[model samples]
Structure formats: C-alpha cells, structure tokens
Target: MILRTEIATILKAPPIGETVTVMGWVRAWRGNRFMVLNDGSSAETLQVVVDGEQFDEETIRGIGFHAAVSVTGELVESQGAGQAVEVIAKELTILGKTDLSTYPLQPKRQTMEFLRENGQFRMRTNTFSSVFRLRHAVAFAINKYFNDRGFYYLHTPIITGNDAEGAGEMFRVTTFEPDSAPRDEAGAVDYGQDFFGKGTHLTVSGQLQAEIGALALGKVYTFGPTFRAENSNTSRHLAEFWMIEPEIAFADIDNDMDLAEDFCKYLITYCLENYLSDLEYLDARIVEAEKNLPKDKRRPMGLLEMLRFVVEDDFARITYTEAIDLIMRSKPYKKGRFEFPVSWGVDLQAEHERWLVEKHFKKPVIVRDYPKDIKAFYMRLNDDDKTVAAMDVLFPYIGEVIGGSQREEREDVLRQRMQEMGVHEEELAWYLQLRTFGGAPHAGFGLGFERMVQFITGMGNIRDVIPFPRAPRLADF
Candidate 1:
C-alpha cells in the first residue's frame, strides 16, 4: 500500500511516477466534476479528480468541507507551484464528516475575531492550520536550541504558597466551598483549613523555584504554564500563558541579555529555515490574508543577523530616570501623540513601551535600573538605593518581549526588601535560604510564549496564535 505522503514532499518531487494515497478533508468542491481536498499536511490542496463510474453516488455526494477522507490515485506532474501534483483518485474512503448544516467554517475568509469564537474547528481552516504547525515547530525549536546548548530542562511546581514574581496576580485554586467551609473565629473563609493546611494559589511565575535548580546545576530552563489573575483583556494579555524562563547562575544582567537575544534569534532562524513551508503559509494566507507582500516584509531575516542585531545592534540603554526625562521633554499639551501619559518614577505601560521601542529607538531597546518601588523585591538594589537592577527588553511590534533583572544576592538586602514589601516570610524560607548558602549573582528572564509567536508570525493578537486561550469571557472550546 502507498502510504500517504505530505503534499509539500510530493510537490518538491516533480515527476510523480507511482500511485499515492492522501488523507485529509474536502476543502472545496466545484460543480460535480472537480474538488480540492486539504490533507492537513500542507497549505497546498490535492486535486481530487473523482469519477462517477468507479465511485458510488453516495461516496461522491457524501463529502463536505472538513470531512476526513482517504484518497488513492495516480500522481501526475502539474504545471503550477501549489497545484504542482495532481492526484487522480481511483478509490476514495470517507473517514469522518462535520455536519455542514451547523459547521460555521465555509470555503471563505474568516476574521480573527470570528475564528476565536469557533476555535475547535478553526484548526481545519487554512490560516490556523498553518499557524498551528508553525507554532508547534517554533516550540520544538525552542526546546532544541536550549537542549543543544547543554541546558537542563526543569519542571517547577504549579501550586505554590509563595508568589514568585510578586505581581499579586495569582489565581487561588482552593477546595474551600463558600457554602459549607470551615471558618475561623473571625468568620472569614478559613484558608488554613484548606488543602495542604494552607492557602495555595497557582504560580504566577516559575522563575524563583527554577532559580534553585539553576543554582545547583549551573544552568536550567523551564517551559510551563503560568497563571495570572490580572483581569486584563488586551491584544497581548492571557490569563494562562506559557513562559519560557532560563535562569543562569553566576550570570549578570548583561550575560542574561546575551542569552535572551541568542535564544530569540535561534527561534526565529529555526522557523525560517526548517519551518519555511509552514511559515510561508502563515505569511501568505493568514496575516496578509493571501495578499501580495512587499519585499522587506516578505520573509523574516536570517537568524545570526537577528541575534547579532539584538545584542550588537544599536541598543539604547536608558535608565528609568532618563526614560522619564525623555517623556517629560515631549509634548506638554500634545495632540495625536504619546498615547499614554508618562511621568518620572511611574511604571511604564504598553503604549509607552511601544513608543520607546517602536518609535523612539526603532530597534530592540533595553531599559534598566527601574525604581525599587516599581520593581520586584528580588531585584538587586543599586548603590543609588532608589533604582533596582531590573530591565525590560522592548521590541518594535511586541512590547516587553523579555523581562529580567540581576537578583538580590545579599541576604540582608533581600530580607529588608521582603520586609518592606510585607511578603509572607514564613512561606519563603526555602527561597531565602538560597541567598544564605552560596547564591551567586544570578539572573533570568521570562519570555512570553505568545509574545514570541507574535514576533515570529506577525500575528497581532495573543488569542490568534494559541490553540485554546483562557481569557476572561472566552474558552467555550
């Protein structure tokens, strides 16, 4: 039996000599004679030339869009690129069929908004199939790039009593029922009586625990789902998102940035070279809506150049004070400029980040030395005592792609900061002990997996790239 081959492979080999069997869905049907079937292998469709003589009326009339089928036919060379090879099917087997009466996906274009509503069947669409394949390739490429560099892949705990990032955005996953839950003398829902004998919440970031293993192993990376309860419904925000964090012991902020740039460039280059076919589909069909693209934005740049550009590129390193000064010098009462209001010692918003990276510097910019009040407590305090050694890498399209900082290695400083922030010291003994016993000047960054997708594919929204997004008012699928 001729096992089914990918359409891309068949397209590459021009002279189709033997009979081939392709299994996929009926993408479109024209008249009673011609039909196009997408084999879920590639963006290109197979010309399923059905004949009434050999096939029954039920077989011919039963097929519809997204209907799974197996086709065996003789391969013939074609005169076009996407339509390169033509499969003249001799026997067609129906595998599975979707009820077209209720099926929302037609042989037409779908907006990203509409597609979000029907995520289950969205993978069957041309654009999403390409997006999904490229996403898979990029994720695998991330693992490959890190693993090849002798990095330990670590899995951190999800439910934790300590908040790692200190963002106060953790989702409480408790078993305490509101109706019949054990209460304290104060009549409040007694979290102490809950599971684990204490109140536990889903982890907001795995950086802290992952740092422990990194300290022991010298280098480690974690790829896992991190939950946040920030109530943010934006183009780039997700309630639950995958974070790729690599913590390196004995590494400073500069070393951490180098690794970040190298990792980002590797992911991009891996996709451009290995997943070119999938990327082409995403660029050709999805983002541009199959429109003809310009030359500069045609394909992504080479990997090494991308990496070098990120590191050696004109990186404008400005302190938080300097950034605030720049914002203050800008239009006092401006019209059609500076979307978000910015002031000194204020946390930068998404629009401000976009301005700094997308418009001001027009390249990947790293803004460091943020005020201690606005930065995390674990970040090392500078000699100035006002600003912490924290940094955020803001790219052009996607703002704040990577966030890292030199950790507070001093035990006294860490305890002081934790005390100032009113953190539950009893719960963070293990973490604080890392500082006491040979904790080097370590650093790491959390790269949002969806933001990486946005950077690679040029997809605008986070919802578009993820298979199943867990947002505020979504997730029926």
Candidate 2:
C-alpha cells in the first residue's frame, strides 16, 4: 500500500528520494511536464513534475486544471526558482477530470462578487483558501484560549423559544402551512399546533443558554451557529453565522471587559504566530485591493501590523457617554459630515463606531455603560438608572465585534426590566428562576465569528469569510 502525503507536508519537509502518493486537484499545468497541485491542505501548492514519455499518453492528456489526480512521485529538491521542492512523478492516474469549458473557476483573477456566485467552488481559490485557513486557526485559538483557562465547551440549543437578543429578528420554525395555519378565537395563528407546541425559532445568540452552563459548571463557552432573519443586504449582515459566546459566573461587568479584551488579543496573537504565511498573503491582497480606493479610505496599517498592534497595545476603554461626547465634538459631526445622528441616547451607528476606533483611538476600543434603552434588557442596570453595564468591543474596520454585559442577578430587577421591555415573564420562567435562586453576578459576550475572520483576513465582505454565507435572498448551495 502506498502512503498518501499532503502537499503541505511534502513542501514542508521534502523526503528526498522517498516515494509518496500525492492526491489533489490540479491548479495549473505547463507544457504537460509541471503541474501545480493543491489538496486544500495548506495555502501552498505542490509542483509535480511529470515525465510524459514514461507515463501513459492518455494519463498525461487527462491532466488539466481542477482535475483530481493521484501522482506517485519521488520527493526531490526543486530546481525551480519559486519553490524549494518539487515532486517527480513516477506514475500518474487521473481520478476525476473537470471540464474546464464548463468549470466556474478559471486560472485568473476573480472578483469577490464572482467568487460568491460560485461559492460552492470558491474554496479552491488561493484567496478563499487562505481566508478559511486563518478562520480555522482563529477558531482553534478561541477553544484553546478558553480550555487553557478551565472553561468548558458548552453546546447550546440551535432552536429555542426565547428571544435572546430581544431584537425580534429570529427565523421562525413552524410545521403549519404559512398563511393557512389554524387560527384561535382572536384570529391569530394558533401556535399550539406547531411542532414544538409553541413558537420556536432558530437561536439568535447562545449567551442566554450559556449562562445556564456557567451557573452549573462555573465557566463555559459556546461556539455554535446562530440565525437572524433580518433582511439586511450589506457587506456586514448575514442571515446565518457562527457566534462565540462565553459566560462567566460570579463576574461583574469589569471582569467581562477584562476577559473580552484578553480574548481578542489572544486570538490576534495566535493568528500572527501560527498563520503568518496566510496572513502575509492576505496582507498583500488587502494592500492591492485598497489601492483603487480613495486616499483617505485606505487603512493606515497593513494586516500584520494591525494584528500585532492589537496584541501589543491595550484596547482603549471608555464609557458610552465619553464616546458620544467625542463624536459630537469631532469634525465629522460638527461639520455635518456624519450620516447617522450622534445623540447621547441614540444607538451608535457603524459610522460613529468607525470614527471612534479608526480615527480617534486608532486601536480596538471597548465602550461600556451604554444607555439602558438602547441596549438589551438583560444588561445590569447601573445605580444612576440611566445606563446599563453593557460593553461593546469595537474594531478598526468592523464596528462591533463583541457585545455583552453583566447580567442582572436580582429577580426583582430582572423581572421589572423584562416587564418594561415587554418580554413575557411566563415564557422565560426558567431563565428568571436563575435569579430567584442562587444567581450570582454573571457576565458574558457574543463575538461575531465571521466578522472577526473578516477583520483578521483583511476581507471586506462578510460573505467571503464564511464557507457558504446565508444572506437576504442569497442561499446559493
């Protein structure tokens, strides 16, 4: 039996003169002698040199771009200038032949839009592969960062009855026919006949359930898929995406802030050290992509520099009021250049967040103590009765990367807040009971995993980072 070797491993430590079997799709072929093969193992490709005279003529002719092939080769030091090692093909077998005439991907530059249209096959591209590799590294780093700190990886439910964010953007799950479901006395659609015996939806966030895990297990984190049904067609919004939510028991808002900052820094540092090659490639891509943009729109720091800065520098910590004051006094707002209104009570828009992180701070900023009305009801109420102990970690290009708060532990306060926010107290009885019992001060935050990848990979569109993005009217395979 022949041993299969990945292209990455062969390229890393080429076993000179050792026979190995390499299997992957052909990326490119030149003069039927040199073929670049990629197996999605690493961002790099293996240069397979074949002797056509020794191999079957049909096999040599079958080799084409995107054709899956098995190449039995001897690893040898490369004579080529671009790579260090190349494989000398002893025998070649075409496993799958892809017709280039109908293939969506070509051996040329492709726009993000075109790549997204062919998302089913986009992972084969160097850019998407690099982005996904970095994404994997970031996720692994997240688990390691938590696991090293004695945090249990919790798997929360994907479907739930509670509106975690109270945003009312949940995707409804029902068994009844739409517009033809049984109606009650009030002429409202009867939910009792539904599959779950009540209204259910795809979860918006796992933080609420993660709190249960934290209460029972002390510290827990959830990395899972979440859904939102908002019809947003932007570079940032996604109908479905993964979220990393960590809940810590007996921790206050300050502790949450500390944990959030440390977590962000750890992820950035992990990628910088582990995925530097992919990062370097992405950095160059970002620089080249921004070259056509306006002078003022281009980022001041490259991808690696930005990641290093996040790891080295401390995140600027400020209160929401402080940020509002800065925004109001800034040139954009003063000169009426800001598109969104920047009042003290109004929620911070993307424009306001960018100015705070990109222009004013020039670093990641953790803005806490937002106005109570503008934030979720579960956030702990401050003594002033005006603001909640909520925090948002804003990034340079991405506005809000993480959002969390110190949950209200007191049953009376929690119930009152729920009532004021029009959340049904009966439906969340189990959740509210946590406060009724020995509910200690708990804090947690939800980090948009896709957005983090976007920031890390220097990719502008959120759709490019996720494997298959679910967005408004765009669920292409």
Winning model by TM-score = 2
Model 2 residue runs over 4 Å out of place are: 30-32, 55-61
Candidate 1 lDDT, tens digit per residue, 317-360? 77778877766665531553666677777888766776676557
lDDT of each: 0.79, 0.89
Separate clash counts for every candidate: 0, 0
Model 1 segments more than 4 A misplaced: 30-32, 52-58, 79-82, 285-316, 328-336
**Judged by lDDT against the true structure, how good is candidate 1?**
0.79
lDDT of 2 by residue, 1-477 (tens): 856888878777788889989999888876678999999888788888988688877878777678899988788888978888888988888889887788888878889899898888888888989999999999999999999999999999998999988989899999898868999999998899888899999999888889999999999999999999999999999999999999999999999999999999999988888778789988998888889999888886788887886788789999999999999999989899998887889899888998998889988899999999988889999999999999999887678899999999988998889999999999999999898888899999999999899999989889889998999888877
TM-score of 1: 0.89
